[model samples]
Target: MWFERPPGVPDWSEAESYLRRADPALGAVIDRVGPCTLAPRRDYFVVLCKAIFTQQISTAVATTLFGRFRDLFPNRRPTPARVIEVLGRADPAVLRGCGLSRQKTSYLADLAQHLADGRIPTRRLAGMDDEAVIEALVGVRGIGRWTAEMFLIFTLNRPDVFPVGDLGVVDGLRDVFNLPARPTPAEALALGERWRPYRSIATWYLWRRGSVPVAAPAVPVPDAVAGAPPCARRRRPRPAAAPGAAISPARPRAQK
Candidate 1:
């Protein structure tokens, strides 16, 4: 598991049982994928910053870069103030030396600034609902809806989120239903409502659905069923998906 399971997260045992009952196809996936492993870190700033470092990079590469990133601060913790101080420097060579791309550096700076200025008040997130948390996270420069949704699921452990634009979700859903083409965002949204408040758990299983044979998927896999892991279907990210934008909570309901 990338993160250690925090004590406050949902009851894995109960969630699995509920999900198994709510979504049978997903239940098969859960049986194949094994236990839910969503252990979230408590530090909001660090999670978002590391998310920036991880953008568009391989896992080994991201690991190396994050290690170098940790070297910049004492006790290996890049607190908001410490990161802000580093970004504020005229040269900022120390930060760039971590092998982060220029765009990623800018992203880190923006996130740190958000935390420092209270644009993203980490302390208040626990009290905020899912949409509110997404809004606050996407307000930071260089972050978009995909990142915010991931933060909601993986970091905050919000159980109901359904990231329709995520390739894993799309691919997983496609395979589960044996669809001829990938479902659009709106289509996925409609299909997902059956899972309701447990959609996040359903999503976790869907992410790994590609790796397992669907319990009762029909014969002859479609072109759309090509194996793939769930990531932002827009792997890097897409624009914000919020109420004010020309978008829904999922990706803008794109035309097929």
Candidate 2:
């Protein structure tokens, strides 16, 4: 009778037991991965803005850019109003100096306006369901289904979201399930349904599966998976198929 609970919900032991009963395949992953204790971000605006900067880039580059973007505010949290003001006064090149492309700058500007004007209702998102948040956020120029879904998982802490477009998630599912090939977006969604009501928690474990330990020395990445979004498929090689050892090499893609 155990089932996976949302972020604010307690009784993880019961939820884990429920998930084990619901899908033994995922249960195996749970056993291997151990518990999920992901901390959700409270700042929706900053997260979405950072998602734009992270698209199609390496993590080091994203880190650098994110730091620079934050420095524009200099010890502040970079609210939407301040972002819009800075964007208005600063040169496009100035914003680009933070590693944003011209397109992303435009997207960021649009996103700031939406939040500033109450179009996105960023403050009210906590009360909305996943789909409602997605619909509301996607109306902004740069935000898409994938970005909205990430916001749900990382920002809102919604437990049921399944970001099938994410290369890491797709590859993680393939390796965990021992599929013949990587699943298409549709197929990934279908497979993720089995982890219902706590797919976000499941996703954290999947990412962990493919993730190299923080202290592990860097290893050469293998060739990218075909059809994966640019810069999102470079993965550390998995050791020859052993149970609990199959890791996806795919990186997180910042889908626009």
Candidate 3:
């Protein structure tokens, strides 16, 4: 249950009522989970970079790496300038020492460049529609459809943006619909239609019911790299708690 909701988060009361009326299956999920506690955050620059850091790595590696990355900037703040400066170095050891791969470092460079050059209108994202926000974000290196969707749900707190591609959502469908196996993306999208306009919240409950797949990169990747392919993930997808804390790859504010 939410002890406190930050400013402007839509009331879950209305969503809960509608979902309960619309689908009893999801209502069961909501009842068991208690309440939606998705606390969206600001600091778009930092969040975007966090998403990049999580690419193609496990949560433990991502967490430690992002912490070291914070050390690169003054006062442990990762401004665009700081990222640009550190990544600009000729030697690879600069970021590699933090366990970042060349691909991830390059992705971070692209993101920092976009922000520093005013490519992404971060301040205006709240006003943009879901598609518009996805468009703006995907233009940056490493930010893809899936990454944008997570950003929508977790960062902007959008009400409807269902991520059919997410393995966790599909796995949850297996439990909710009692399917023999995880639904295909197309199958998942079609099934998700029942929850329309509140799929994001419905998905939160689904995540509570199923496994949140380990961190996959923004770019296309094999299931092995992401830890589990869709068909096999249900066998042992990490608990939802892992993704809740590590999906973004951002460190705590108090990290010194």
* Model number with the top lDDT: 3
TM-scores of the candidates in the order shown: 0.78, 0.76, 0.78
Candidate 1, residue 1: Cα displacement in angstroms equals 19
Q: Please, what are the lDDT tens digits per residue for candidate 2 over residues 97-135?
A: 898777887888898999988988967899988888999
User: What tens digits encode model 3's per-residue C-alpha lDDT throughout 8-76?
Assistant: 665687887788777776776566555677767888888889878777676678788999889888888
Error of 2 at 59 (Å): 2.6
Model 3 clash pairs are none
Evaluate all candidate structures by whole-model CA lDDT and list the values in order: 0.70, 0.69, 0.71
Ranking of predictions according to lDDT: 3, 1, 2
Which candidate, 1 or 3, has the higher lDDT?
A: 3
lDDT digits (tens) for residues 169-222 of candidate 1: 886666676555677786677667767878888888776554455644323233
Clashing residue pairs in candidate 2 are: 2-18, 235-249
Candidate 1 structure lDDT: 0.70
Candidate 1 regions exceeding 4 Å error are: 1-10, 90-93, 217-256
CA RMSD for every model? 10.0, 8.6, 9.3
